[model samples]
Target: MTATTTGGLPVALLLPGQGSQHPRMATGLYSGEAAEPEFAAAMDEVFTAMGAAGKPLRADWFAERPTVPVDHVTRSQPLIFAVDYALARLVMSRGVRPAALLGHSVGEMAAAVLAGVFTLPDATALVLDRVRRLADAPPGGMLAVAAAPGELEPYLGDDVVVGAVNAPRQTVLAGPEAPLEKTGQALRDALFTCRRVPSLTGFHSPMLEPACRGAEELFASVPVRAPRITIHSAYTAGPLTHGDVANPAYWARHPVAPVLFWPALDALLSTGDHILIETGPGDGLSRLARRHPRVRAGTSKVLPLRATEHGP
Candidate 1:
Protein backbone atom coordinates (compact mmCIF):
# COMPACT_ATOMS: atom_id res chain seq x y z
CA MET A 1 0.00 0.00 0.00
CA THR A 2 1.09 3.56 -0.62
CA ALA A 3 1.96 5.69 2.38
CA THR A 4 -0.86 7.63 3.99
CA THR A 5 0.82 10.93 3.42
CA THR A 6 4.06 12.40 2.02
CA GLY A 7 3.31 15.36 4.27
CA GLY A 8 4.23 13.23 7.25
CA LEU A 9 7.82 12.70 8.35
CA PRO A 10 9.49 10.15 6.06
CA VAL A 11 11.85 7.33 6.82
CA ALA A 12 15.06 6.89 4.85
CA LEU A 13 17.11 3.72 4.88
CA LEU A 14 20.84 3.90 5.64
CA LEU A 15 23.07 1.04 4.54
CA PRO A 16 26.60 0.78 5.99
CA GLY A 17 29.70 -0.46 4.22
CA GLN A 18 32.98 -1.92 5.47
CA GLY A 19 34.16 -1.99 9.10
CA SER A 20 30.71 -2.78 10.49
CA GLN A 21 30.60 -6.56 10.28
CA HIS A 22 30.86 -9.32 12.89
CA PRO A 23 30.46 -13.09 12.59
CA ARG A 24 27.18 -14.82 13.42
CA MET A 25 25.34 -11.52 13.30
CA ALA A 26 21.52 -11.45 13.29
CA THR A 27 21.20 -15.13 14.16
CA GLY A 28 17.72 -14.52 15.44
CA LEU A 29 16.58 -13.80 11.89
CA TYR A 30 16.69 -17.58 11.50
CA SER A 31 14.58 -18.43 14.49
CA GLY A 32 13.10 -21.45 12.72
CA GLU A 33 12.13 -22.96 9.39
CA ALA A 34 8.99 -20.81 9.31
CA ALA A 35 10.31 -17.66 10.96
CA GLU A 36 10.46 -14.35 9.09
CA PRO A 37 9.50 -15.82 5.74
CA GLU A 38 10.45 -12.70 3.86
CA PHE A 39 13.96 -12.49 5.33
CA ALA A 40 14.60 -16.20 4.86
CA ALA A 41 13.23 -16.27 1.33
CA ALA A 42 15.14 -13.15 0.38
CA MET A 43 18.35 -14.55 1.84
CA ASP A 44 17.86 -17.78 -0.01
CA GLU A 45 17.38 -15.91 -3.26
CA VAL A 46 20.59 -13.91 -2.76
CA PHE A 47 22.70 -16.90 -1.75
CA THR A 48 21.37 -18.97 -4.64
CA ALA A 49 22.35 -16.15 -6.95
CA MET A 50 25.87 -16.62 -5.56
CA GLY A 51 25.93 -19.97 -7.45
CA ALA A 52 28.44 -22.55 -6.24
CA ALA A 53 29.70 -20.32 -3.45
CA GLY A 54 26.22 -20.08 -1.93
CA LYS A 55 26.57 -23.05 0.43
CA PRO A 56 29.84 -21.99 2.00
CA LEU A 57 28.69 -18.40 2.09
CA ARG A 58 25.62 -19.32 4.14
CA ALA A 59 27.69 -21.67 6.31
CA ASP A 60 30.33 -19.06 7.08
CA TRP A 61 27.58 -16.63 7.92
CA PHE A 62 26.15 -18.95 10.57
CA ALA A 63 29.37 -20.70 11.52
CA GLU A 64 30.49 -20.44 15.13
CA ARG A 65 34.10 -20.47 13.95
CA PRO A 66 34.22 -19.33 10.36
CA THR A 67 37.06 -20.83 8.34
CA VAL A 68 37.95 -17.40 7.08
CA PRO A 69 37.67 -14.38 9.33
CA VAL A 70 35.06 -11.75 8.47
CA ASP A 71 37.86 -9.17 8.16
CA HIS A 72 39.03 -10.11 4.66
CA VAL A 73 37.32 -8.50 1.70
CA THR A 74 36.73 -11.97 0.26
CA ARG A 75 34.42 -12.71 3.17
CA SER A 76 33.37 -9.38 4.59
CA GLN A 77 32.39 -7.57 1.40
CA PRO A 78 29.99 -10.19 0.04
CA LEU A 79 28.65 -11.11 3.46
CA ILE A 80 27.96 -7.51 4.32
CA PHE A 81 26.20 -7.04 1.00
CA ALA A 82 24.01 -10.10 1.55
CA VAL A 83 23.06 -9.09 5.07
CA ASP A 84 22.31 -5.52 4.04
CA TYR A 85 20.28 -6.57 1.03
CA ALA A 86 18.30 -9.10 3.03
CA LEU A 87 17.69 -6.62 5.82
CA ALA A 88 16.35 -4.08 3.34
CA ARG A 89 13.94 -6.67 2.06
CA LEU A 90 12.86 -7.46 5.60
CA VAL A 91 12.13 -3.81 6.27
CA MET A 92 10.19 -3.36 3.06
CA SER A 93 8.23 -6.51 3.81
CA ARG A 94 6.81 -4.90 6.92
CA GLY A 95 4.73 -2.56 4.69
CA VAL A 96 6.97 0.42 5.23
CA ARG A 97 8.08 2.04 1.99
CA PRO A 98 10.95 4.34 2.78
CA ALA A 99 11.13 7.72 1.10
CA ALA A 100 14.79 7.30 0.15
CA LEU A 101 17.90 5.14 0.63
CA LEU A 102 21.51 6.07 1.38
CA GLY A 103 24.48 3.77 1.30
CA HIS A 104 28.17 3.94 2.22
CA SER A 105 30.69 2.28 -0.14
CA VAL A 106 29.83 -1.36 -0.91
CA GLY A 107 26.50 -0.80 0.75
CA GLU A 108 25.61 1.32 -2.27
CA MET A 109 25.44 -1.81 -4.39
CA ALA A 110 22.68 -3.15 -2.22
CA ALA A 111 20.79 0.11 -2.51
CA ALA A 112 21.19 0.12 -6.27
CA VAL A 113 20.03 -3.45 -6.59
CA LEU A 114 17.00 -2.73 -4.48
CA ALA A 115 16.36 0.29 -6.65
CA GLY A 116 16.44 -1.90 -9.78
CA VAL A 117 19.66 -0.50 -11.21
CA PHE A 118 20.78 -4.12 -11.48
CA THR A 119 19.10 -7.49 -11.25
CA LEU A 120 19.86 -10.17 -8.66
CA PRO A 121 21.97 -12.37 -10.96
CA ASP A 122 23.80 -9.36 -12.35
CA ALA A 123 24.52 -7.99 -8.90
CA THR A 124 25.77 -11.33 -7.70
CA ALA A 125 28.26 -11.42 -10.56
CA LEU A 126 29.29 -7.84 -9.92
CA VAL A 127 29.81 -8.39 -6.19
CA LEU A 128 31.84 -11.53 -6.81
CA ASP A 129 34.04 -9.79 -9.34
CA ARG A 130 34.47 -6.86 -6.96
CA VAL A 131 35.58 -9.22 -4.23
CA ARG A 132 38.10 -10.98 -6.49
CA ARG A 133 39.67 -7.72 -7.63
CA LEU A 134 39.90 -6.11 -4.20
CA ALA A 135 41.25 -9.25 -2.59
CA ASP A 136 44.06 -9.07 -5.15
CA ALA A 137 44.64 -5.34 -4.56
CA PRO A 138 47.89 -4.26 -2.91
CA PRO A 139 47.89 -4.72 0.86
CA GLY A 140 46.39 -1.56 2.36
CA GLY A 141 43.79 -0.38 4.89
CA MET A 142 41.82 2.62 6.16
CA LEU A 143 42.37 4.85 9.21
CA ALA A 144 39.60 6.57 11.12
CA VAL A 145 40.69 10.06 12.13
CA ALA A 146 38.58 12.07 14.52
CA ALA A 147 39.40 15.30 12.73
CA ALA A 148 38.15 17.29 9.80
CA PRO A 149 39.09 16.13 6.31
CA GLY A 150 41.28 19.20 5.82
CA GLU A 151 43.16 18.54 9.03
CA LEU A 152 44.29 15.14 7.76
CA GLU A 153 45.31 16.45 4.32
CA PRO A 154 48.77 17.52 5.44
CA TYR A 155 49.54 14.00 6.59
CA LEU A 156 48.47 12.45 3.27
CA GLY A 157 51.42 11.53 1.10
CA ASP A 158 51.77 10.17 -2.46
CA ASP A 159 50.33 6.83 -1.35
CA VAL A 160 48.06 7.85 1.47
CA VAL A 161 44.91 9.83 0.66
CA VAL A 162 41.55 10.62 2.17
CA GLY A 163 39.20 7.68 1.69
CA ALA A 164 35.95 9.00 3.13
CA VAL A 165 34.53 12.17 4.63
CA ASN A 166 31.99 10.75 7.06
CA ALA A 167 31.21 13.88 9.05
CA PRO A 168 32.38 17.45 9.66
CA ARG A 169 35.02 16.14 12.07
CA GLN A 170 35.24 12.49 11.07
CA THR A 171 37.39 11.32 8.16
CA VAL A 172 38.89 8.06 7.00
CA LEU A 173 42.27 7.83 5.23
CA ALA A 174 43.31 5.00 2.97
CA GLY A 175 46.50 3.82 1.18
CA PRO A 176 48.99 1.00 0.91
CA GLU A 177 50.41 -0.63 4.04
CA ALA A 178 53.67 1.27 4.46
CA PRO A 179 52.43 4.79 3.75
CA LEU A 180 49.24 4.26 5.76
CA GLU A 181 51.28 3.12 8.75
CA LYS A 182 53.73 5.99 8.26
CA THR A 183 50.88 8.47 7.97
CA GLY A 184 49.11 7.03 10.98
CA GLN A 185 52.25 7.50 13.03
CA ALA A 186 52.57 11.05 11.77
CA LEU A 187 48.95 11.82 12.73
CA ARG A 188 49.52 10.30 16.18
CA ASP A 189 52.63 12.44 16.62
CA ALA A 190 50.47 15.44 15.83
CA LEU A 191 48.06 14.31 18.61
CA PHE A 192 45.16 13.40 16.32
CA THR A 193 43.03 10.56 17.67
CA CYS A 194 43.11 8.03 14.83
CA ARG A 195 42.82 4.26 14.61
CA ARG A 196 42.93 1.59 11.91
CA VAL A 197 39.78 0.39 10.18
CA PRO A 198 39.79 -3.39 10.22
CA SER A 199 40.15 -5.95 7.38
CA LEU A 200 39.99 -3.42 4.63
CA THR A 201 42.12 -2.98 1.54
CA GLY A 202 42.44 0.50 0.01
CA PHE A 203 39.61 0.25 -2.49
CA HIS A 204 39.10 4.01 -2.29
CA SER A 205 42.72 5.10 -2.91
CA PRO A 206 44.76 5.58 -6.08
CA MET A 207 46.28 2.17 -5.54
CA LEU A 208 43.09 0.62 -6.98
CA GLU A 209 43.33 2.49 -10.28
CA PRO A 210 44.07 -0.63 -12.25
CA ALA A 211 41.25 -2.52 -10.58
CA CYS A 212 38.84 0.32 -11.21
CA ARG A 213 39.87 0.50 -14.84
CA GLY A 214 39.50 -3.25 -15.23
CA ALA A 215 35.96 -3.12 -13.88
CA GLU A 216 34.73 -0.87 -16.69
CA GLU A 217 34.05 -3.65 -19.18
CA LEU A 218 32.39 -5.80 -16.56
CA PHE A 219 30.23 -2.95 -15.34
CA ALA A 220 29.20 -2.11 -18.89
CA SER A 221 28.28 -5.71 -19.53
CA VAL A 222 25.33 -5.53 -17.19
CA PRO A 223 21.95 -4.02 -18.01
CA VAL A 224 21.49 -0.70 -16.22
CA ARG A 225 18.28 1.10 -15.46
CA ALA A 226 16.96 4.07 -13.52
CA PRO A 227 16.32 3.43 -9.86
CA ARG A 228 12.71 2.95 -8.82
CA ILE A 229 13.77 4.24 -5.42
CA THR A 230 15.71 7.41 -4.67
CA ILE A 231 19.29 6.46 -3.80
CA HIS A 232 21.38 9.12 -2.09
CA SER A 233 24.89 8.40 -3.32
CA ALA A 234 27.93 8.95 -1.09
CA TYR A 235 30.10 8.87 -4.20
CA THR A 236 28.30 11.84 -5.70
CA ALA A 237 26.87 13.22 -2.46
CA GLY A 238 23.48 13.49 -4.15
CA PRO A 239 20.63 11.46 -5.53
CA LEU A 240 21.74 9.30 -8.46
CA THR A 241 20.76 10.55 -11.87
CA HIS A 242 19.73 8.34 -14.78
CA GLY A 243 22.70 9.66 -16.75
CA ASP A 244 24.98 8.60 -13.92
CA VAL A 245 23.73 5.03 -13.43
CA ALA A 246 23.45 4.37 -17.17
CA ASN A 247 27.08 5.27 -17.69
CA PRO A 248 29.67 2.52 -17.36
CA ALA A 249 32.31 5.02 -16.31
CA TYR A 250 30.30 6.02 -13.26
CA TRP A 251 30.07 2.49 -11.93
CA ALA A 252 33.69 1.81 -12.93
CA ARG A 253 35.01 4.82 -11.04
CA HIS A 254 33.35 3.88 -7.75
CA PRO A 255 36.21 1.72 -6.52
CA VAL A 256 38.65 4.62 -6.31
CA ALA A 257 36.32 7.49 -5.52
CA PRO A 258 36.36 9.32 -2.21
CA VAL A 259 33.04 8.67 -0.44
CA LEU A 260 31.31 11.93 0.51
CA PHE A 261 28.88 10.32 2.96
CA TRP A 262 28.36 13.36 5.17
CA PRO A 263 27.47 15.54 2.23
CA ALA A 264 25.03 12.95 0.94
CA LEU A 265 23.49 12.48 4.37
CA ASP A 266 23.16 16.25 4.65
CA ALA A 267 21.34 16.33 1.35
CA LEU A 268 19.05 13.48 2.34
CA LEU A 269 18.02 14.90 5.71
CA SER A 270 17.95 18.54 4.70
CA THR A 271 14.70 18.39 2.76
CA GLY A 272 12.47 17.53 5.78
CA ASP A 273 12.09 15.50 8.92
CA HIS A 274 13.40 11.96 8.33
CA ILE A 275 13.99 9.09 10.67
CA LEU A 276 17.18 7.52 9.31
CA ILE A 277 16.80 3.77 9.70
CA GLU A 278 20.08 1.87 9.56
CA THR A 279 19.38 -1.41 7.75
CA GLY A 280 22.84 -2.90 7.89
CA PRO A 281 24.78 -5.17 10.24
CA GLY A 282 25.63 -2.71 13.02
CA ASP A 283 24.79 0.74 14.37
CA GLY A 284 27.77 2.54 12.80
CA LEU A 285 25.73 4.74 10.49
CA SER A 286 23.15 5.38 13.21
CA ARG A 287 25.89 6.67 15.50
CA LEU A 288 27.00 9.05 12.77
CA ALA A 289 23.43 10.07 11.94
CA ARG A 290 22.85 10.92 15.60
CA ARG A 291 25.45 13.68 15.23
CA HIS A 292 23.17 15.51 12.82
CA PRO A 293 21.36 18.62 14.07
CA ARG A 294 17.89 17.27 13.30
CA VAL A 295 18.41 14.21 15.48
CA ARG A 296 19.70 16.34 18.30
CA ALA A 297 16.72 18.70 18.06
CA GLY A 298 14.25 15.80 18.30
CA THR A 299 12.84 16.49 14.86
CA SER A 300 14.37 13.22 13.56
CA LYS A 301 15.62 9.93 14.95
CA VAL A 302 17.99 7.13 13.90
CA LEU A 303 16.89 3.52 14.19
CA PRO A 304 19.33 0.61 13.74
CA LEU A 305 17.45 -2.55 12.82
CA ARG A 306 18.48 -5.93 14.14
CA ALA A 307 17.23 -9.40 13.26
CA THR A 308 14.30 -10.02 15.57
CA GLU A 309 12.59 -13.39 15.86
CA HIS A 310 9.72 -11.84 13.91
CA GLY A 311 11.40 -9.41 11.51
CA PRO A 312 13.83 -6.50 11.15
Candidate 2:
Protein backbone atom coordinates (compact mmCIF):
# COMPACT_ATOMS: atom_id res chain seq x y z
CA MET A 1 0.00 0.00 0.00
CA THR A 2 2.85 2.36 0.80
CA ALA A 3 4.28 1.79 -2.67
CA THR A 4 1.26 3.45 -4.32
CA THR A 5 1.56 6.81 -2.52
CA THR A 6 3.07 8.56 -5.55
CA GLY A 7 4.45 12.05 -4.80
CA GLY A 8 2.71 12.01 -1.42
CA LEU A 9 -0.68 11.35 -3.07
CA PRO A 10 -1.85 7.78 -2.68
CA VAL A 11 -4.04 6.47 -5.51
CA ALA A 12 -7.47 5.43 -4.25
CA LEU A 13 -9.62 3.10 -6.34
CA LEU A 14 -13.40 3.82 -6.20
CA LEU A 15 -15.54 0.76 -6.81
CA PRO A 16 -19.03 1.60 -7.99
CA GLY A 17 -22.20 -0.32 -7.29
CA GLN A 18 -25.39 -1.07 -9.29
CA GLY A 19 -26.53 2.34 -10.59
CA SER A 20 -23.07 2.88 -12.11
CA GLN A 21 -23.36 -0.02 -14.57
CA HIS A 22 -26.28 -0.42 -16.98
CA PRO A 23 -27.48 -3.28 -19.11
CA ARG A 24 -25.31 -4.10 -22.14
CA MET A 25 -22.64 -1.84 -20.58
CA ALA A 26 -20.06 -4.55 -21.11
CA THR A 27 -21.37 -5.69 -24.51
CA GLY A 28 -18.49 -4.48 -26.64
CA LEU A 29 -15.71 -4.05 -24.13
CA TYR A 30 -14.35 -7.55 -23.64
CA SER A 31 -15.75 -9.76 -26.34
CA GLY A 32 -15.85 -10.11 -30.11
CA GLU A 33 -13.96 -7.57 -32.23
CA ALA A 34 -13.98 -4.96 -29.53
CA ALA A 35 -12.24 -7.11 -26.97
CA GLU A 36 -9.43 -5.48 -24.98
CA PRO A 37 -6.66 -7.94 -24.07
CA GLU A 38 -6.24 -7.03 -20.41
CA PHE A 39 -9.96 -6.49 -19.86
CA ALA A 40 -11.00 -9.67 -21.65
CA ALA A 41 -8.44 -11.73 -19.77
CA ALA A 42 -9.61 -10.40 -16.44
CA MET A 43 -13.27 -10.94 -17.33
CA ASP A 44 -12.39 -14.48 -18.39
CA GLU A 45 -10.85 -15.03 -14.99
CA VAL A 46 -14.07 -13.79 -13.35
CA PHE A 47 -16.16 -16.15 -15.47
CA THR A 48 -13.89 -19.02 -14.56
CA ALA A 49 -14.19 -18.14 -10.90
CA MET A 50 -17.99 -18.20 -11.18
CA GLY A 51 -17.93 -21.60 -12.92
CA ALA A 52 -21.10 -22.81 -14.75
CA ALA A 53 -23.22 -19.89 -13.54
CA GLY A 54 -21.12 -17.46 -15.51
CA LYS A 55 -22.11 -18.81 -18.95
CA PRO A 56 -25.42 -16.95 -19.15
CA LEU A 57 -23.75 -13.85 -17.80
CA ARG A 58 -21.12 -13.90 -20.56
CA ALA A 59 -23.78 -14.77 -23.14
CA ASP A 60 -26.16 -11.97 -22.12
CA TRP A 61 -23.31 -9.50 -21.85
CA PHE A 62 -21.94 -10.31 -25.30
CA ALA A 63 -25.28 -11.02 -26.98
CA GLU A 64 -26.77 -8.57 -29.40
CA ARG A 65 -30.02 -9.34 -27.60
CA PRO A 66 -30.45 -10.80 -24.15
CA THR A 67 -32.84 -13.44 -22.74
CA VAL A 68 -33.43 -11.39 -19.60
CA PRO A 69 -33.29 -7.65 -19.12
CA VAL A 70 -29.68 -6.76 -18.31
CA ASP A 71 -30.82 -4.73 -15.32
CA HIS A 72 -32.33 -7.68 -13.53
CA VAL A 73 -30.59 -8.13 -10.17
CA THR A 74 -29.78 -11.71 -11.18
CA ARG A 75 -27.43 -10.31 -13.82
CA SER A 76 -26.79 -6.65 -13.02
CA GLN A 77 -24.83 -6.96 -9.78
CA PRO A 78 -22.68 -9.79 -11.12
CA LEU A 79 -22.18 -7.90 -14.36
CA ILE A 80 -21.25 -4.75 -12.45
CA PHE A 81 -18.87 -6.85 -10.39
CA ALA A 82 -17.29 -8.23 -13.56
CA VAL A 83 -16.90 -4.86 -15.30
CA ASP A 84 -15.61 -3.08 -12.16
CA TYR A 85 -13.12 -5.81 -11.33
CA ALA A 86 -11.88 -5.96 -14.94
CA LEU A 87 -11.63 -2.19 -15.25
CA ALA A 88 -9.56 -2.04 -12.06
CA ARG A 89 -7.37 -4.81 -13.41
CA LEU A 90 -6.92 -2.97 -16.71
CA VAL A 91 -5.83 0.16 -14.85
CA MET A 92 -3.47 -1.86 -12.67
CA SER A 93 -2.06 -3.44 -15.80
CA ARG A 94 -0.77 0.00 -16.71
CA GLY A 95 1.27 -0.18 -13.44
CA VAL A 96 -0.90 2.26 -11.43
CA ARG A 97 -1.91 0.33 -8.32
CA PRO A 98 -4.21 1.66 -5.62
CA ALA A 99 -3.11 2.06 -2.01
CA ALA A 100 -6.67 1.88 -0.73
CA LEU A 101 -10.07 0.80 -2.10
CA LEU A 102 -13.49 2.29 -1.37
CA GLY A 103 -16.61 0.61 -2.71
CA HIS A 104 -19.91 2.39 -3.24
CA SER A 105 -23.00 0.18 -2.84
CA VAL A 106 -22.45 -3.13 -4.63
CA GLY A 107 -18.98 -1.92 -5.36
CA GLU A 108 -18.20 -2.64 -1.70
CA MET A 109 -18.25 -6.36 -2.43
CA ALA A 110 -16.10 -5.81 -5.49
CA ALA A 111 -13.54 -3.89 -3.44
CA ALA A 112 -13.42 -6.75 -0.96
CA VAL A 113 -12.52 -9.14 -3.75
CA LEU A 114 -9.91 -6.75 -5.10
CA ALA A 115 -8.53 -6.06 -1.62
CA GLY A 116 -8.08 -9.77 -0.84
CA VAL A 117 -10.71 -9.59 1.91
CA PHE A 118 -12.51 -12.30 0.03
CA THR A 119 -11.01 -14.70 -2.49
CA LEU A 120 -12.52 -14.42 -5.96
CA PRO A 121 -14.40 -17.68 -5.57
CA ASP A 122 -15.78 -16.65 -2.19
CA ALA A 123 -16.93 -13.26 -3.40
CA THR A 124 -18.41 -14.85 -6.51
CA ALA A 125 -20.45 -17.23 -4.39
CA LEU A 126 -21.74 -14.44 -2.18
CA VAL A 127 -22.67 -12.30 -5.20
CA LEU A 128 -24.42 -15.17 -6.95
CA ASP A 129 -26.32 -16.07 -3.82
CA ARG A 130 -27.46 -12.47 -3.37
CA VAL A 131 -28.66 -12.38 -6.97
CA ARG A 132 -30.60 -15.59 -6.49
CA ARG A 133 -32.24 -14.48 -3.26
CA LEU A 134 -33.29 -11.13 -4.68
CA ALA A 135 -34.47 -12.54 -8.02
CA ASP A 136 -38.03 -12.84 -6.72
CA ALA A 137 -37.96 -9.79 -4.49
CA PRO A 138 -40.60 -7.16 -5.16
CA PRO A 139 -39.61 -5.26 -8.30
CA GLY A 140 -38.42 -1.77 -7.35
CA GLY A 141 -36.50 1.26 -8.63
CA MET A 142 -34.58 4.35 -7.46
CA LEU A 143 -35.08 8.10 -7.83
CA ALA A 144 -32.27 10.67 -7.84
CA VAL A 145 -33.48 13.68 -5.93
CA ALA A 146 -31.98 17.15 -5.81
CA ALA A 147 -32.64 17.68 -2.10
CA ALA A 148 -31.15 16.91 1.27
CA PRO A 149 -32.23 13.68 2.95
CA GLY A 150 -33.91 15.63 5.75
CA GLU A 151 -35.93 17.73 3.31
CA LEU A 152 -37.14 14.54 1.72
CA GLU A 153 -37.97 12.88 5.02
CA PRO A 154 -41.71 13.43 4.71
CA TYR A 155 -41.75 11.32 1.55
CA LEU A 156 -39.80 8.43 3.02
CA GLY A 157 -41.28 5.42 4.82
CA ASP A 158 -40.92 1.68 5.25
CA ASP A 159 -41.34 1.39 1.50
CA VAL A 160 -39.37 4.33 0.18
CA VAL A 161 -36.10 5.11 1.94
CA VAL A 162 -32.87 6.92 1.31
CA GLY A 163 -30.71 4.73 -0.86
CA ALA A 164 -27.56 6.73 -1.36
CA VAL A 165 -26.19 9.97 0.02
CA ASN A 166 -23.92 10.92 -2.86
CA ALA A 167 -23.76 14.55 -1.76
CA PRO A 168 -25.48 17.01 0.53
CA ARG A 169 -28.32 17.48 -1.97
CA GLN A 170 -27.69 14.68 -4.42
CA THR A 171 -29.68 11.97 -2.68
CA VAL A 172 -31.32 8.84 -4.13
CA LEU A 173 -34.61 7.37 -2.88
CA ALA A 174 -35.36 3.74 -3.56
CA GLY A 175 -38.33 1.40 -2.95
CA PRO A 176 -40.88 -0.83 -4.67
CA GLU A 177 -41.92 0.24 -8.17
CA ALA A 178 -45.40 1.51 -7.22
CA PRO A 179 -44.35 3.35 -4.07
CA LEU A 180 -41.32 4.79 -5.79
CA GLU A 181 -43.42 6.01 -8.69
CA LYS A 182 -45.84 7.60 -6.31
CA THR A 183 -42.99 9.26 -4.42
CA GLY A 184 -41.40 10.49 -7.63
CA GLN A 185 -44.66 12.03 -8.71
CA ALA A 186 -45.01 13.60 -5.27
CA LEU A 187 -41.55 15.06 -5.52
CA ARG A 188 -42.31 16.40 -8.97
CA ASP A 189 -45.48 18.02 -7.66
CA ALA A 190 -43.44 19.63 -4.89
CA LEU A 191 -41.17 21.02 -7.65
CA PHE A 192 -38.12 19.02 -6.70
CA THR A 193 -35.71 18.31 -9.53
CA CYS A 194 -35.39 14.57 -9.91
CA ARG A 195 -34.56 11.76 -12.31
CA ARG A 196 -34.92 8.01 -12.38
CA VAL A 197 -32.08 5.67 -11.45
CA PRO A 198 -32.28 2.83 -13.94
CA SER A 199 -32.39 -0.89 -13.19
CA LEU A 200 -32.04 -0.45 -9.47
CA THR A 201 -34.20 -2.45 -7.13
CA GLY A 202 -35.24 -1.40 -3.59
CA PHE A 203 -31.68 -0.88 -2.52
CA HIS A 204 -30.80 0.59 0.90
CA SER A 205 -34.33 0.19 2.17
CA PRO A 206 -36.59 -2.11 4.14
CA MET A 207 -38.29 -3.14 0.91
CA LEU A 208 -35.44 -5.60 0.47
CA GLU A 209 -35.85 -6.98 3.98
CA PRO A 210 -37.45 -10.24 2.94
CA ALA A 211 -34.68 -11.13 0.59
CA CYS A 212 -32.00 -9.98 2.98
CA ARG A 213 -33.58 -12.04 5.76
CA GLY A 214 -33.77 -15.16 3.61
CA ALA A 215 -30.08 -15.05 2.81
CA GLU A 216 -28.83 -13.51 6.06
CA GLU A 217 -27.00 -16.72 6.72
CA LEU A 218 -25.08 -16.84 3.42
CA PHE A 219 -22.08 -14.97 4.78
CA ALA A 220 -21.56 -17.39 7.64
CA SER A 221 -20.03 -19.95 5.33
CA VAL A 222 -18.02 -17.40 3.33
CA PRO A 223 -14.82 -16.72 5.21
CA VAL A 224 -13.75 -13.12 5.74
CA ARG A 225 -10.09 -12.17 5.99
CA ALA A 226 -8.44 -8.85 6.78
CA PRO A 227 -8.01 -6.68 3.72
CA ARG A 228 -4.56 -6.67 2.09
CA ILE A 229 -5.28 -3.22 0.71
CA THR A 230 -6.84 -0.68 3.05
CA ILE A 231 -10.64 -0.45 2.70
CA HIS A 232 -12.82 2.47 3.72
CA SER A 233 -16.35 1.24 4.30
CA ALA A 234 -19.41 3.23 3.27
CA TYR A 235 -21.38 1.77 6.18
CA THR A 236 -19.06 3.02 8.86
CA ALA A 237 -17.87 6.11 7.03
CA GLY A 238 -14.30 5.11 7.90
CA PRO A 239 -11.74 2.34 7.63
CA LEU A 240 -13.14 -1.19 7.93
CA THR A 241 -12.11 -3.33 10.86
CA HIS A 242 -12.51 -6.92 12.00
CA GLY A 243 -15.63 -5.84 13.90
CA ASP A 244 -17.47 -5.08 10.64
CA VAL A 245 -16.94 -8.67 9.51
CA ALA A 246 -17.37 -10.38 12.87
CA ASN A 247 -20.85 -11.56 11.89
CA PRO A 248 -23.03 -12.15 8.83
CA ALA A 249 -25.36 -9.27 9.76
CA TYR A 250 -23.02 -6.70 8.27
CA TRP A 251 -23.09 -8.31 4.84
CA ALA A 252 -26.86 -8.75 5.12
CA ARG A 253 -27.31 -5.03 5.67
CA HIS A 254 -26.12 -4.29 2.14
CA PRO A 255 -29.44 -4.26 0.32
CA VAL A 256 -31.32 -2.80 3.27
CA ALA A 257 -29.07 0.03 4.44
CA PRO A 258 -28.43 3.49 3.15
CA VAL A 259 -25.15 3.93 1.25
CA LEU A 260 -23.20 6.62 3.10
CA PHE A 261 -20.85 7.22 0.19
CA TRP A 262 -20.35 10.91 0.75
CA PRO A 263 -19.53 10.50 4.42
CA ALA A 264 -17.05 7.70 3.70
CA LEU A 265 -15.50 9.83 0.94
CA ASP A 266 -15.33 12.78 3.29
CA ALA A 267 -13.37 10.66 5.75
CA LEU A 268 -11.11 9.42 2.96
CA LEU A 269 -10.24 12.86 1.60
CA SER A 270 -9.93 14.27 5.11
CA THR A 271 -7.06 11.90 5.77
CA GLY A 272 -4.96 13.52 3.01
CA ASP A 273 -4.73 14.52 -0.62
CA HIS A 274 -5.37 11.47 -2.82
CA ILE A 275 -6.17 10.60 -6.38
CA LEU A 276 -9.68 9.14 -6.46
CA ILE A 277 -9.89 7.01 -9.60
CA GLU A 278 -13.30 5.74 -10.65
CA THR A 279 -12.45 2.16 -11.57
CA GLY A 280 -15.71 1.67 -13.37
CA PRO A 281 -17.33 2.65 -16.66
CA GLY A 282 -19.05 5.87 -15.58
CA ASP A 283 -18.12 9.19 -13.97
CA GLY A 284 -21.05 9.28 -11.52
CA LEU A 285 -18.87 8.86 -8.44
CA SER A 286 -16.22 11.08 -9.94
CA ARG A 287 -18.80 13.82 -10.36
CA LEU A 288 -19.71 13.53 -6.68
CA ALA A 289 -16.11 13.36 -5.46
CA ARG A 290 -15.16 16.43 -7.51
CA ARG A 291 -17.61 18.49 -5.45
CA HIS A 292 -15.39 18.02 -2.41
CA PRO A 293 -13.39 21.04 -1.23
CA ARG A 294 -10.11 19.18 -1.62
CA VAL A 295 -10.74 18.38 -5.26
CA ARG A 296 -12.23 21.81 -5.84
CA ALA A 297 -9.13 23.36 -4.29
CA GLY A 298 -6.91 21.32 -6.66
CA THR A 299 -5.45 19.33 -3.79
CA SER A 300 -7.04 16.04 -4.99
CA LYS A 301 -8.22 14.56 -8.30
CA VAL A 302 -10.81 12.22 -9.77
CA LEU A 303 -10.50 10.31 -13.07
CA PRO A 304 -12.87 7.94 -14.82
CA LEU A 305 -11.24 4.72 -16.04
CA ARG A 306 -13.81 4.02 -18.77
CA ALA A 307 -15.87 6.93 -20.03
CA THR A 308 -17.62 4.37 -22.25
CA GLU A 309 -20.60 4.70 -19.90
CA HIS A 310 -23.97 3.86 -21.46
CA GLY A 311 -27.04 5.97 -20.79
CA PRO A 312 -30.50 4.81 -19.75
Query: What overall lDDT, based on C-alpha atoms, would model 1 receive against the true structure?
Result: 0.84
Top TM-score prediction, candidate number: 1
lDDT per residue, candidate 2, 100-200, as tens digits? Answer: 88898889888988888788888888888888878878889989999999999999875888989999899999999998999999999999999998665
10 residues in a row with least lDDT, candidate 1: 1-10
lDDT of 2: 0.83
Clashing pairs in 1: none
In the range 1-312, model 1's lDDT, one tens digit per residue, is 232234467878899888888887665575565367677778888899999988888888888899878888888888888888888888888777888999998899999999999998899889888888888788999999999987877898877898999988999999898889999898999999998887568868999887666788998889999999999999999999998898888777777899999999999988887878888888889898899998889888777885342454
How many residue pairs in model 1 have overlapping backbones?
0
Would you estimate the TM-scores of all the predictions?
0.94, 0.93
Count of backbone clashes, every candidate in sequence:
0, 0
Off by over 4 Å in 2: 1-6, 32-34, 308-312
Error of 2 at 24 (Å): 3.1
